[model samples]
Target: MAVAAGCVVATLTADPSWAVQRPDPRPAAQPAQLSAPARPSNSDLEVVRLDPDPAPPGGTTTVHAFVANLGPETTASPFTITVVLPKGVTAQGPFFPTDCADLGDGHVVRCTFGPGLKEGRSATALVPVLLSPDLQLGTLTGGSVSVFSPDDRNERNNRQSFDIRVVETAAG
Candidate 1:
């Protein structure tokens, strides 16, 4: 027996002295047809939020943007994570990936991660944020974090909204 293209082939042989002089009534064997392997299925990438610590107006803080693959398959392509800050906050870089791009006048940032993220594995982006000096002391809403990839098909869990609470600084 021999294996070829995911198929098995068998061969048989007989001695001439033991064989009758008659035509064999079996049909000839045909070559096996080979098909291309199927492509991998889509992955599931989710944004696991890690909200920033409360900071006073004009103070700086870090936003932990955690992303995970709740995947049945590993990623087959690269993906990107975007962080959008609220009105009163802005991104101050020294970002985790070092290549994270600041966009929309510092209120938004985009970070990239290479493929091959296995199930339960995660990637994180640390974005330093600075609150405006004249901002009010309260929860700053409208901030968001989102993920995108050609290998991910679940759109529902790809994005999540966040809030940055601004508090008053205590003087020692």
Candidate 2:
């Protein structure tokens, strides 16, 4: 076929000193090709709200919960902070005296806030949760508040979800 089309047009018109360039040892602080973290979306993190948004079903609700460790880098040490309770709520403590840990797929009732939390360091947890006057008014969905760490070694820490809302208290 015409000597293979003139040897591919003389090797693509080679003239740049017999071209075969290869000297990009790459290292100008090379670090941009990391696409595997786009699967975690929670709009980042930082939520703490518990105002007078309805609290009277028997009384007692002083939720402070104000966590912040938005981490740009500097939050590695134990790392834990959980709060999942809202189905007739009931969790009052001095912080770290847990005993209702069974979320093995039976809905939810987990409450753990311990060991670590200090990146941007905005801690402020004063949970005195209680709302069980035979609970039957309305609105008490799934409530949640989590923050974990320890991802690969597998000791437990790879849980992050946030959402909490409670309303319905004025039928006394």
Candidate 3:
């Protein structure tokens, strides 16, 4: 401290007329020039589609979907996956004991199940869909599956869709 003070005193004495002390000048930092962002390669964000289970005429198919956090982002909560019942099929009971229901699109149903989606985590749900007795004994096709991010409250994300197909049921 004494040596620093002595240095300051010597500097001030050398420039006695100066009222205020001046600090050494430093180089100013230039504003950073940001480069344009790279365009997406069409290879990013691949969404793994889900498929619905197939049911046969006069039979019941319990569809269990494997839901997973298949993204790099950490979901604050588990994602809600709704299985909308397709045509010729009927929902048996309450979807999940909560804010979800069967919209009964004949081939589509919506369900919301929970907690949250952590990275690399997965969950599953059972969908009991009863096929109509009148369905032809051939391969019944055209089914859909989907998942959303509604936190057990609302379903604002409906753009996501999954593909599902059902083959004909065999004779009992």
Top candidate, metric TM-score: 1
Off by over 4 Å in 3: 1-55, 94-99, 104-108, 150-172
State candidate 1's TM-score: 0.75
TM-score of each: 0.75, 0.27, 0.50
Q: What is the per-residue lDDT of model 2 for residues 53-108, given as tens digits with 9 covering 90 to 100? A: 45656555644545565545433343344566666666655443344344553234
lDDT of 3 by residue, 24-96 (tens): 6976545543453322121111123455555556777765555555445545443556565556767665444
Off by over 4 Å in 2: 1-20, 24-52, 58-66, 70-80, 84-130, 135-168
> What local distance difference test score does each model get?
0.87, 0.48, 0.51
Of 1 and 3, the candidate ahead on TM-score is 1
Instruction: Locate the minimum summed-lDDT window of 10 residues in model 2.
Output: 35-44
Give the alpha carbon lDDT tens digit for every residue of 1-172 in model 1: 3345456564544645567477779865555423432344579999987779999999999988889999889887788999999998889978989999998699989999988889889999999999999998999989889999888889899999888889999797
Q: Candidate 2 overall Cα lDDT vs. reference?
A: 0.48
Q: Which stretches of candidate 1 lie over 4 Å from their true place?
A: 1-41
Ranking by TM-score: 1, 3, 2
